[model samples]
Target: MTSIKIEHVVHEKCRIGESPVWEEKEETLLFVDITGQKVCRWNPKTNQVVSVSVDAPIGSVALRKSGGYVVALGTRFASLNWEDHSTSTIATVDEDKPNNRFNDGKVDPQGRFFAGTMSQEIRPAVVERNQGSLFTLFANHSVVKNFDQVDISNGLDWSLDHKTFFYIDSLSYAVDAFDYDVNTAKISNRRHLYKLEKDEGIPDGMCTDAEGKLWVACYSGGRVIRIDPETGKRIQTVKFPVDNTTSCCFGGKDYSEMYVTTATNGMDEAKLAQQPQAGGIFKITGLGVNGIPPYSFAG
Candidate 1:
């Protein structure tokens, strides 16, 4: 195993920091503080951090090829102005389920935004209810329903070849692979590629490296584990200083650096005191791997 050093890069004290994305063109890292209702940009080169406040809880954001960003604000997909932080509605989702909100999402290789919703009530006992679902928003501002009955739709990425789509529904404790159509943005033939035990922790956000291996952040396990998608076995583990590791993405000049985001949402005062770095962003180097560039929304 290769040892790596993890350092805190941002100390925003976010309530729920998630959706870390690397913008290779600008050499900046973009992520969201869901409960804090803010979108943040961190530029390591200049050591600067900029935040834009949003009206509602923001689940995720994707760079737009057209000039700004496509954001998942609460239950609506909206266009966000990078300079003014103004948002215009593009489409709304899951309006019938008022208690549900968008959780985690990413842009596909073909330029479509994929996101999923989860129940806001946070009831772990009632896993039987299908309160969440997965969706895809295309360049035309059209939305499509992909799957239903999802408890907590989190983490999504596609293989290098764009043939397989990997996803996580946190409550299932498993990573699923689906047959994908890059041209049509359709997914099918779902199968479980990996399943984590109770002690291993539930999978949250994920990204694929150059080798096609998946690096998954464990929500309660306080670590990011690299898994070999082909065999569904663990390859490496990167432990963090906090217990609520939310998401991670590979960035840096050569895409060798891994940036991770953590949360302090459910921790008590005692627990928060123990993990002072919780809700901050972290960077990990010396992993001996590179990540593919993140895709931007075409519209």
Candidate 2:
């Protein structure tokens, strides 16, 4: 197995940087600053950086097929107006449960938006166990609860063949898979695909290559791992110096380069002094695996 090195590309130390979606049409990298409550776009071609603040903490973002983006705004899923930074909620969940917020999210091949939720307060815990749920945004603009009891839902990706889903329960340090139904947008046959020991750090955001291998980010491990989901075998481990790698995705013209995002949210001053490049974007080239294009919002 070959290891990859990371080069610091963005300077801002995001509290938490996750969910990266490559917008092919715009040729831009779209991501979210969760604790910063904003959506950011990076244009490498012009060295342009644009960020727009939202009312609530934004979790994840996905490009829409209809020409906009679907945003997870803590408690709701909405459509964003890139021009004015305006948002309109497409669906809301647990309106009565104010202590929950949306976490990780992605669009399936069928164009449905799937997002997960988590309790807001880590201490003085907001909700009882089993409250967090995975939700689906339908064509009629309605939200349906798909599953529950998720703890800090993080990475989410589907296999290239569209037959399997890979997800991470960050707090559990485990990666799981489910038999995915592309047509019905249902997931079943849940099975444990991989698990990270506490020493390896929590599993965060992830993506799948064209070969169907899953590339998962190690939140506190400071590395990204490429694994064979079927056999649960680790094929490669890409290391980063910092200890807060948040998420990664395959981008670039050929989709062979892996773009990674990191965070410095909970780092101590001493640790920050040692790894100053903790919260920055990175790119690793020459990885043999290629990523499939992300699905656009069809609504």
Candidate 2 local lDDT, 1-299, one digit each (tens) = 45544567777678788888888788889888887888999887986779999999888999887777899897999999999889998888978778888888998888888888887745311234555788888766878887887877678889888898888777767899999999988889888899786667878889888888989889789889888987998888888888888889988787877889888786789989999987778888867667989887678
lDDT of each residue in 1-299, candidate 1, tens digit only: 56688999988788889999898778899999997999999989887989999998899998999988899989999999988779999999998888878889899988899999887745321343578899999999999999899988899999999999999998888999999999999999999999986776779999999999999999889899999988999888888888889999999978999999998887889999999999999999889899988999997
- For candidate 1, the per-residue lDDT at 25 reads 76
- lDDT against the true structure, each candidate: 0.90, 0.83
Please list the residue runs of candidate 1 whose C-alpha ends up more than 4 Å from where it truly belongs after superposition.
123-128
How many clashes show up per model?
Answer: 0, 4
RMSD of each: 1.6, 2.1
